[model samples]
Target: MIDRRRSRRSFLKLAAASAAGWWASLSPAGFAAEREPHRKPIPSSGERIPVIGMGTWITFNVPDAPGPMAVRREILGRFFARGGGMIDSSPMYGRAEAVVGDCLRALDRPEALFSATKIWTRSTSTGREQHADSLDLWGAGRLDLQQVHNLQNWQAHLETLRERREAGEVRYIGITTSHGRRHDEMERIMRSEDLDFVQLTYNILDREAEQRLLPLATERGIAVIANRPFRQKALIERFEDHPLPDWAAEIECENWPQFLLKFIVSHPDVTCAIPATSVVAHMGENMGALYGPMPDAAMRERMVAWVGDL
Candidate 1:
């Protein structure tokens, strides 16, 4: 019988080594230009960010217990070492925001950190309080991005977000939804609101955003942060027994994680895809998507059809 635990440890070791080797291969100029994973511009400001980013949802909602915190610290270390920047979390995610703070503190606070979190309450007063708590938890004087989680009382919170942005308390303001919920309302808000970003669930299997939301974001010049790139691990679990399509190599994908993430970030409208993982080895594999070649329109279609057949 296959020893799954042993296999996982071996794969993690190999992945870490491969990540180090990939970094060593880049030239100074390449590094300065940020050309390894490639970057996409935030449509509103034209500021570029790496296409692959880290997410702290369920993966980061850990207790203050030493062992669990150490694992999270290692995951954050691997993320920054691999050129990751944006780290998305929320007040809704239990202790995730606080855990992120702990991990960053242990890492001595990376300059590349682009912290993003959400205000997830109905009361504007509570939203303000929550936003302040998030900044405290993240140890950032000014948050890079603040979103309205699931569009909860977005109307009230967006006003405050705009005010904060104008005062330079936050760099960007936006809203979010997930699990394929509230697309119609999301679309209305996207049309009517002056948002710099939008977080939503989109992956290889969940293509509903492609029909309207993505195209509308492109038209409105809004940056898109794609969450659930692996559909909350459902995609991975579903395809665990299946082999990647032979043509996946055209995009330089060696594994399922890379294949899935590349599909999300390669879309024209997607500024970044935040894939969360508690495992350090999975972080390596996730960041690997940022390094390799990406798919074009034709290859993307093939990828879609290939996965659809299964």
Candidate 2:
């Protein structure tokens, strides 16, 4: 039976222990034995990545001032310290890529940094230039993944990405859309393109991707990265007054972020969920979803109904 009495504080304590490497020792069964952070594989390469990753959209777009930059550095430090792998950003987010470079430099370049960014320009030559600029901005020799942001001039940029992938400058290529925009075109790209990853917005409140994009990714063996898992804080503010459902304990969810994030990452085709946040406390809560039990299909259905009723 599940422990219904486990409060949010208790869950945080467990996460803190895990973060501090208290469970580093192996059990007699020859595994770490304690509940480790869940990982999902990239379908194209079969590479396993942690289900919870950091997103640098508005969150990391800070000025180079000492106080603001230091906060971002602490957030990045806590992220790597807590087993975060994929850090998603885009050139569209002003100064975010450069700030990420600052954080990496401050952290002495963490090995766990899975640098993922996008190309958001028109011409092939400009796309190439932007891609190179992102590399310099992030201080990465080669990007782990390069995507077409919002599919802007995707045809032209894709050609460049294909060449770069062949030239060993990028490990994977994909496209992304957000706020439920242009999914039909997104689906076409997913169907026709030989892409490795595709990112879209999916959350308890927004389920439009369920109809096509997600299943197509599964069919085509493309990894999925879910954005806006909290629906840009709209879902949180809507349910702040309401208490968590009693059954949330069944899957080890203690707060709204964990509850919502666990719902996204639990999807069979979702490789990871990139929830952007500037605050370290919220980042910790988001990473907490990486630990503990995830809901199965029946429970996910219940979650949908539970949130829909509110």
Candidate 3:
């Protein structure tokens, strides 16, 4: 087990000091942490994580109290029990890191967790500090993947990330943008930077990444993490009243969460798709996508055709 408190205190010192001169720190994985049915290897390390990872956008920004924290603990427990990995969060999400830390501690720190978070600060000098805060907040030993959230001050943060990666303080480095923002700039960075991963919005509705970013990730050997897989649950609410496609069961999609998530992760270039949910049942439905068959290129087109009509 990781001594998160000790790790946090140590990182606080490093994050606060002039040590490394904006060149340094935040950074965990355990057990096999990789579940069976389906897993994708990271392009840089070949580390396989489940395709249906959890996201903590609004779903995990709960108060640090027993009532809210207990529910979150169960929700996360359902995820790990379902063989999930690559739990993605950001400091920008209020109290999410702390909530997640409480949940992880509650769950006894599952061995299958692929902890991924971002450095969202625009100040390069405070970038390392933010990373440490995330580590401290999550009670995590280290971050498995540290991303430049929304590409804010991406260049400097990526430099610090590279240094941390070299020192084993960080594992993978990447940049992120969402809601179809800044594809042109993202493309430029993807081409120029030596990145291990790149996260952006890609879903049944958001196919823009397919035109450039998705293919570029494959070309550059950079893993891709798809966020807003459900368009922040708007897709689910929109389609819940509609019936699943008759062939939905062809891919073992039993609900909208499974249907929507399967469509995103089925894309060959997409490494994982994170759909946020606070409900235990919803989390179960999201994790179900990791099982059974996946949609193929033809089926994916059919998915777009169906959902795009609804």
The list of candidate 2 runs beyond 4 A from truth reads: 1-35
lDDT tens string, model 2, 190-309?
989899999999999899999899999999999999999887778888887888999999888889999999999999989999988889888777777888889999999999999889
Determine the backbone clash count of candidate 3.
Answer: 2
Per-residue lDDT tens digits of candidate 1, residues 1-310? 3699889989999999788667765633234335466689998888889898988889999889999999999898888877889999999899999999988998999888888999999999999999899989999889999999999999999999998888888999999999889999999999998889999999998989999999999999899999999987888898868999888887778889999999999999999999999998898889889876889999889889888999
Q: TM-score of every model?
A: 0.89, 0.89, 0.88
Output candidate 2 Cα RMSD.
7.9
RMSD of each: 9.8, 7.9, 14.6
Decreasing lDDT order of the candidates = 1, 2, 3
lDDT of each: 0.90, 0.89, 0.87
Q: Which parts of model 1 are misplaced by more than 4 Å? A: 1-35
Top candidate on lDDT is 1
Candidate 3 Cα errors over 4 Å, as ranges: 1-35
Candidate 2 vs candidate 3, TM-score winner? 2
The better candidate by lDDT, 1 or 3, is: 1
